[model samples]
Target: MTPHPPTWIRVSECFLSLQGEGPAAGTPAHFVRLQGCDVGCHWCDSKYTWGKSGGREISIDDALDEVRSLGEAPMLVITGGEPLQHEGVYALLARSLGRWSRVEVETSGVEPPRMSHAHLFWNVSPKLPSVTPRWADTWAHARAWAQAPNATFKLVVGSERDRDDAVRLIAEHEVPAARVMLMPEGLTDDVVRAHAPIVVEACKRHGYRMSPRLHIWLWGPKRGV
Candidate 1:
């Protein structure tokens, strides 16, 4: 008898929602939030997902069933505490690619993704110096993704210092300015508004595009949006 392919994936949560950040913002998508990350960004909105034990394991078939249940989402977004941290994500991404027209993976840029399907869009968000105990591994992953045809660099800018770090990273990795998105770092609409001008100025100064946190603006910082 042939052995069965692994059916399980470590997942934090799954829901259907609009793509909140990046160039794909406003596009309706199915979100598969995987569990665990060590990047430990100070302003991470998904703090609940930081621990592997905090998430439940579900069969890959069941996860795909949930995606199909979403009706006709334009894409499948595999996000996380950091999706690349899970080895099973490769299988999940591969399976999703067969069904969805587009598959987007949002990662912290700490580890290189194992799967590199043509349809996979890598949204690499590398943490700035403020994130603490920075990982040296982020550079290799960032460099690889920078060269990827379907990848974009979405840097979260909280201060002028963060903006400087972003510029350095973009230049070092040779990421295209057009493919780079500078997002204001905030969870609330008020905070976002306060930081918007600074981020917009940074974008203009550096020739990068500005990405707004649409989900937070529409629904605050609540879950399952």
Candidate 2:
């Protein structure tokens, strides 16, 4: 018999944190943040995780063991820089789906999903023009990700143009209103509070859901929750 090489991945950090945004907000979740991102959104809070150099490598089995020791969080979130960027994450999801009551993958939708549509809660946020000018590429992904049975869309609103574009795309792509969420973009509590009105007004006018950066309100802008 031959031995198989241990599957390893670049991990920025793993922690037990409250899901800060999306339909599962406030849920106690185990978070596995992978390193490296091609999306390159300028306003991304986790900039320390922007490239391959940011995180350390660990075997997949060790990561699972660490999460097992972190107490019983009901949910597991495989997020990133971009989780889908690492092929080993598919293995992570396969092992974790049985452990957590719920599992989510928070993604920017820059790359196509490779998870074989295994049951997952995908918090799919297609970056708006304010963050990056990748219109055609991202929307193409949005259209596909929106079709997942448990997917939800969250767009970050920095200005009216961003809000308007969100509405335009949702309509063009025909994503359900209740499944679409809008969050105000900011690094500070006050800034998030200030920008929230714009997001609220957009939600009111268009009937989209609203997501508060709950972690920011509770703990301010810091890494590792």
lDDT of 2 at 63: 88
How does residue 6 of candidate 2 score in lDDT? 36
* Model 1 bad stretches (over 4 Å): 1-5
| TM-score on alpha carbons, each prediction | 0.93, 0.93
lDDT for each of the candidates? Answer: 0.84, 0.84
lDDT of 2 by residue, 27-52 (tens): 99898888988777888888888888
- Assess the local accuracy of residue 92 in candidate 1 as a C-alpha lDDT between 0 and 100: 84
Quality of model 1 by C-alpha lDDT: 0.84
For model 1 the local lDDT of residue 79 reads 95
Clashing pairs in 1: 7-60
